[model samples]
Structure formats: structure tokens, C-alpha cells
Target: MVKRLGLFVIGFSLIVVIIQVAIPSADGRFEQADATPEKRPFLIVAGLDSLTNGALTHKTKSRYLDTLIPQMHKTYGDGGPGYVPFDSIYFKQDHHQLKMSRRLKEINDLEPGQYPSQYSFDLKGLYTNKGRSDWLRFDLKKDWTYGRVFYLQQPDGGSFKIGYRHQKFIQVDTGGSLSLKTIELPKHVQDRQVVIRHISGKVTLFGGIFLKNGGVAVSRIGQGGDLLRWHAQLNNAFMKQWLQQLKPDLLIFNGGTNDRYRSSVGEFRRHLRHYLKPFEASKCQILINAPNAVKYKQKRLLNFIHSMKAYAKQHNDAFISNQKVLGNTFQEAQQAGYMGDWVHPNHRGTKKIGNQLFFYIREHVLPSYKKEHAGF
Candidate 1:
């Protein structure tokens, strides 16, 4: 009996060791794991205005993302660009290769009663292509085994074809009620150009294309002149579905620039909470990033920042203030060559902002995450 008990204990210890070796750590380390990189850590930065689009100062690459993304890849393996917006109104796609047969009509206006709104009816970050032969091609900068295409299914929605390399195109029908849909490619795709071709109907694309393989991925979801309340107008179910699909390990909300004058403190808080409710049950960490200092509405912007800080504290989440790095006042930032105008940051200014965020993650976020997920 004593010998049997000892053997049982030894077997249990071996099982535990095997489990640990099979699982990947939150910091993206794995031992004796499969070659497939499906469970890589993902970060999403969702913001408004300049955070969504670029600053007034023209540039070849994004202001902060160009600096931040490369740094992150160096530290935690390369995971392809997280989200690529289809709209090119104010955003330039320079990180990857993209070719469109023809420019798609960008849509921002929403019909009356389509959504709950008090001031704006624009859909913000959605684009549609109606031409039957129109096609968009995306060539990834890095190798990725997984990809997903996000779009909206509306009453007048049409069909489209998605294919990669020499494989057959998959036809997707979007003739249904208004809702969000995704075409996820789980198969391995390496160094191949992905194409989306319009077949017959009008297809509205949202949240762009998501590509990742392993390691760390940082995605952005921003719309010029976006407000916290505007996000509240989206269907709760739709938002929840989208969040589940993205499955971000860290979600950052960057706002207040556009919301300062438009919404009162209480109103902003309410809208923010409503917008975040879908993520309440998610295991992903939350970060609230306050907008940088602006020349106008200093008092109102400060109020919004304070509210966001308090909310972050109450939720036990991380908070980063752009003012801490950019400057306390608009004049100070302007003098430092950070301001492209009264509100937007110049190229140099954006680089500073990106570096600061990367430092914060290295100093504060990663350490805590490593501690919490130490064993696996």
C-alpha cells in the first residue's frame, strides 16, 4: 500500500509538469509547445480623432504607431498588424502593401432612427464598395497563419469573394438584416497577398482586417471626430460580438479630445461606462488613455481626464495620461515642437508619446502581468 501511494504521487507530479510545459505564458513564452501560434497576446488601442487618424503634420508612417509597433515586436515576437481600416479618408496605410482597383465610396452618414443619437448621425469608421469588379489587395509585412475580415451585413448588402495565393475564392453572402459579420481564415497563410473582390452586392466593411500569428499584436480602432457617446449608439449585441472575436489581451480607450466640449462630465462617464459594459466580463486588462493637452477647453478636458482616472482606479485598471508626457498645457507642448496645431501632435511629439507608452508597459504593465500569470 505504501509503495502504491508513492507511485500515485509521482504520477501526479509528472502530470503537473506536462501541463505547465504545454501552456504558454502570458508574456508569450512556451516550452515544448506546438508550432502553431494561435493564442498570442493581443493589444487593441481604440481612440478618437488624432488617435484614430494622423495629426495635421503630414508623415510617411503613423505618428505614434510607427514607433510603438516596432518596439513591441522587438520585445515580444512579431504578430502581424492587428487591425487595418478600409477607409483612407484621413488615414494612410504605409505599414503594409495595399492596392485597390478603384476608390470605394466612404460612408459616414446614418439614417434617422437607425441609431440613438442626440447630435450626430455619422457612422464614423465604416466604408463600402459597390462595384462588381472592384477588388482590394492587402500584402502583409510579416508572415501570418490567421486572418479575419470584419464587415457589416445590412439589408442592401452584397456578396464578396475572399482568397489568398492561388487558392479558390470563398464567396460570402451578406443579404441579411443589419449586423456584424466576420470571415475568419484559420489556415496558415505565409507571404501571400490576400484579396477581397466585390461580386454583386454592396458590402460595408468595419473594423478593417485583422491579421496575427503569434507573439504580440497591437491594433488600433479610431475614427476622426469620434465621441464616447457615439460608441454608445452601437448595438450592444453587435459590440459584444466584435469584442469576443477580437479577444484582446489588453484594451485601451483613448478619448476626451472630442468629448470635452460635447459632453458633460456625468454624460461622458455614463457613455464611457455604457461603451465598456460589453467588456466587463472579459479577462483582458483595460487601460484608459487621456487625450493630450489642447489649447481650447482646458477646463473641460481636465474634467474628462479626472473622471477617466477615477473610473480606472475604481475598476483596478491601468491609466496613462498623455499630458504627463506631452505637457501640462498646450503652449508647453507647442514650444516643445510636439504640437502640429492647437490640438494635434507633430511627428516628433507623436514619437515621444509612443515611447512613453512603451516605457509604461515595460515598467508597470508587464511586471504585474508576469506576476499574476507566473506559473503559465
Candidate 2:
């Protein structure tokens, strides 16, 4: 009887081992990223704070990140709902259902549209129509749980009347020369149309409309003519104010395209270190992206890219080089009609960059990060 019981126990132990070998760990099949949502949350902080209004609508922002997110999930697994920190900026070129009349300047002076996530709006035109009743009209794309509009007041700035569907109107008095003013949106029962009419002074610039959302939040954070200095200039107080709310576990830094002439290789590395100083206590894993190839400034740009690669290596952080993955020249992209100018790539170029980054993270970054940190 004792011999028979021992044999049965051995057989059961063997079955358990086979089951363990067949099934994946609790985190899921991919060892690339932490699929366990509650453990590690991903956050993408792209573009510049001043450039946040590039894509005003949710749909447009989704277009910018569509390639990256799904591919990220396929490769790294959905790490759950991502977090977006700031929401006071977004701009969509065509708010599909809205109607507009009157001549408005479609200027990309800010060239905010250079970033796929950015939607450069008619700021000067909006500011110019001071006395006109028909300034600008657009239907809200979605019901925002809460919303806000950021505006810049020039020295001559006076006032503007804002109304929602002709229901409620408010006159915002801008004291002359006020740099910036934030208008709090009223809590709405449903999605509605809004109109802006000039009341007094020139509302020279607008940060754009911002809305709240759940799921992966891809933020645009680049400013034209900006180097890495803008990173330190961001509202750190505000960021820390809602750090808990953001709950970010991974922060990806993608810049230096605008910094080709701004810094030498040594300064580039120093600036990167300075930019990262603020987040030292945040405990989020940082990743850096090398700049994409631009037609001019070939040698200086290459030096900057090399510096970024070195920084990523020395610091042991994940680094993805756009120049390496997307090719050394913009010839292919330009031929494909991706270049908007000598410097920036349009939407098509943006999509290609996203795809390349996705594959790199999937094949190289993920596996290495998992081995070092177990998951992130």
C-alpha cells in the first residue's frame, strides 16, 4: 500500500511541472513590458507645453498615437489605462460637425502642426475679430467632464465674450498686457457648441481647449524654437500637484530636433541631465529618443544624436535613435511626401517614426528592461 501511494504522489508532481511549463506567469505572455496594469503605468510626454494645443480634439490625438499604442500593446502588452498630466491644451483642424464662415488666417507660424499631435489653429484670426459677432464657431466633439481654455492677452488686450450655444455668455475682461489668462469652462450637462466674439482687447494667443479622458494619454509637449530648456520650465509645481493623479511609471523623452543649433554635444548631455533632475524622485523609468534627420546642419545634428545615444547608454536607460531606424536621410520620407519643410515631417512622417519606435521597443528595449528591472 505504501509503495502504491508513493508512485501516485510522483505522478501528480510531474503533472504539476508540465502545467507550469505550459502556462505563462501572472504578468501575461510577454516579458517585454509589465502587462500587470496596477504595477506599472505608461506615460508619453511629447511635444512642448506651449505646443499642447496642436490637436484640440480627441480624434486627432488618437490619429497621432494610433500606430504607436496598438503596436505597443501587441508587443509589450496593454499596461492598462495610461495617464496624461496636463489637459489645458488641444486643437483639432476640422471639428467635423461644426460650421464656420468668415475669412480666418490658417497660419502655422508656430508650426505647431509640425508635430502630428499638434493642431495649429487660427490664433491671429480669432484675436482679430474683436467686434464681430461671428468670430469663430465650432461644435464640441465630446462631452468633457471638465474643460479649460488658455489665452494670452497682448498689451492692447481688452475683453472677449464667450458663449455656449447662445445659452450662457460671459465677458472676460483682460487687463492690458496680461501674459496669460485661463478661462474655466462651465460644467456642461452635454456636449455643446461654443462661440467666441471679441469684446475689447486683442486676445493675441490661445493655448487651446483641453478635455479629460481615460486610457492611454499621449501628450504633445514640444515648442517651436525650443531646446531641452523647456523641460525644466514646465510647471513643476503643477506637475507635482497632480503627480499622484498621473501615476506614471514610464516617461519617454523625445526631443533635440529643435536643438541642433542650440547646443553642442557636451551641452546636449548636460541639458538632458538638467531636464531629468526634476523627476528624480518620481521613480518612473526614463527613455530618450534621438532626433530624426533633417536636411540641413548634418554634422552638428549627428553630434547631438551621438551625445543622446551615449547619455542613454551611460545612464543605462532605453534609447531609440530616429536617425538609425528612420534612415540617415529624409530622402525616402520627402519622396513619400512626408516633409512639410526642410525641418519638419508631416503626418505621414510622424506615423513612420511611431512604427519604427514601436518595433525597437518591442525587440530591444523591452527585453533588456524586463531583465534588469523585472518589469516597467
Candidate 3:
């Protein structure tokens, strides 16, 4: 009997060792393995609405994107804020680390009798500095190794000086005619702050990008009152160029609150397909998120949700219904204190929704993705 008990103990110890060796760690790495883990940055592009733009939320931290960003960092590592636009009039970006100070003039790309498709580059949101002293300073909180500046070189374009850490500035001349230009930072340079000084002529700034060595990058592209169909208003060439550059791992389409009263089910379907057309060639994962329940126009919202779910199913895309997380009905959500007004959610509601979304992605989405990509 003593000999048998000792043998059993030894067998269990071997099983424990085998289990530890086979299973990957919480950081997505195998134990005692030399094979480098997936270090490539996982980029998530979210095209949402006011819920993500922080228009209805009283506090900046209460925004869903704010909650999602930190949670994603905890798991996938921090890749720094992905994209930072120049204008804050419509879209409220949450890059507290980077600060800009200058009297910049905002320009809309929409031209009379001409759609965005006619434009060769992105002109939707632009900031111009005509003054020689006019400067847009970037104060970064963390040390970043990679950065890029997006701008348009036009006939009236001027020169701008880019300096690192208050050092000597490098002057770039925006060449004549309309075209897109990208300024990439030297890979060896570790940057803390960047300043764009207006040298001469008109310097039109589109936006900027900041990234770390590895991990996940979540870029929030949202406006206060944007609809999915409004993507049509964006320049197709610019859209393709940006997507090719971004090369997102996952693309999330979130909108419907503004369209609930205005769009029909058929129109919404067409709009979603139109928005997704550019991404089909990329072969990246797509996630369609239904908007939260509202007080009025509940039927219209439900119809939109149903259409979105069906479309996602048809296209083999992932879908999450906010109604499931918040409440199935308007009254249910209101009673649960998730609804702030007839159309939007309060701070508490957004926090709850955001946390739930994080959980869902970590638990369900990531597992399926790993399995599909053979432990990617």
C-alpha cells in the first residue's frame, strides 16, 4: 500500500509539469519557450458616435473609449495613443499626455456641388497656421520611439519647422499642388515632445500619430452627430490610403442613434455595406456593435439592431448588441439608470457598458481569434 501511494504522487507531479509546459501564460506566452510571442501591434479602429466622442458624458474619463483604452493596455500592453486629430470642435480626443497650443484655423473639406470623392486627399478636418509665430506644440507624457505627421501639400502650402525636445528644427516645404505627405520620425530617436513651428506660408495640419515599440493600439474616430452613411462623404482615395497605412487588426463600426429616426432598415443596410466595402480587401476582422436602447423611437432602433445583426451574420463578422449589455428595452435601461436622456447614456451607464465590452472581447472574441489564426 505504501509503494502504490508513492507512485500515485509521482504520477500527479508529472501531470502538473506537463500542464504548465503546454498552457500559455496570461501574457500570451509559453513557459520555458524560446519562440518569440506575437509582438506585432494589434490595431483596433473604432468609428463610433457621441458615445465615444464624449459629447454627452460629463467627465472625460467616463467615456467608453477611455475605459476601453486602459483595460486593453492591461492585457495587450500600451502602444500609445494611435491617432490625434488637430481639431477638437466635433471630436473630443482623450490624449491627455499630448498638449497643443496655438491659434489654429479649422477647415472643412466639404465643397459646394462637389463630394469628398472628388478630392485627391483627406481635407475633412484641417488646421492651418498662417502666422509666422503660430506654432502647434505637442507635450508628450511618455517616451515614444515612433511618430508620424499627416498633412496635405497644396499650392498655397508653406513651410513648417519640426523640432524634437526643443532642439534645432527641421524645415519641410509643402510642395505645390494637392497631395498627401507623411513625415516619419527616425526610428532611433526617442521623442518626448514635438513642436511644429510655422516657418512661412500656410501650413495645413491633418493630424499626428504616436506609437510605442509593441502592443495594442486603439484609435477612436468618432464625431458628435455622425452616421455610418456619412462615411460616403469622406474621400475614397484618402480612405483607402489611411486604411492601408493603419492596417488594423480589427475594425469596429458603431453608430445608429443619429440614424434611428432618419434612416430606414434598407437604407441602414446599404450604408453599412458601403462603409464596409473598403475593408473587404484588407481581410481584417470586423465587429458590428448595435447602439444602446433609447427612450423614444424604440421601434426604429430595434429595427436597426436587427438589420445589423443579420448583416454581421451574413458576412461572418462579430456582432454585439448594446441592448443586451444595458437593457433589452428603453424602460428597462432607464430604470437601471443606464439611460441619461432620451437618446444617450449617463457616466455610470457608459462605464458599465465599456467594462462589459472589454470582458466580451477578452473572453469570447480573443479566444475565437486565436483559434482561427492557430494561436495568433
**Candidate with best TM-score:** 3
Error of 1 at 376 (Å): 9.3
Model 2 misplaced stretches (Cα beyond 4 Å): 1-42, 48-66, 69-214, 235-245, 330-340, 346-348, 360-376
Task: Give the whole-model CA lDDT for all candidates, comma-separated.
Answer: 0.59, 0.44, 0.58
Model 1, position 97, has a per-residue lDDT of 67
TM-score of 2: 0.50
Runs in model 1 lying further than 4 Å from the true structure: 1-36, 56-62, 95-104, 108-134, 141-143, 153-157, 176-179, 186-191, 207-209, 371-376
> In what order do the candidates fall by TM-score, top score first?
3, 1, 2
Model 2 C-alpha lDDT per residue in residues 239-260, reported as the tens digit of each score: 3422333334455566565556
Candidate 3 stretches greater than 4 Å from native: 1-39, 56-62, 89-103, 108-124, 129-133, 141-143, 176-178, 187-191, 367-376
Please give the lDDT score for candidate 1.
Answer: 0.59
Total clashing pairs in model 1: 1
- Candidate 3 residue-wise lDDT at 106: 48
Candidate 3 per-residue C-alpha lDDT over 235-340 given as tens digits, one digit per residue, 9 for 90 to 100: 5545556666556677766777677666788887777776676666565678777777777777877888888899888888889877787898878888988776
Worst 10 residues of 1 by lDDT: 7-16
- Report the C-alpha lDDT of model 1 over 220-315, residue by residue, as the tens digit: 554445556656665556656656656666766777677676789899888778766766656667777777788888898889889889989988
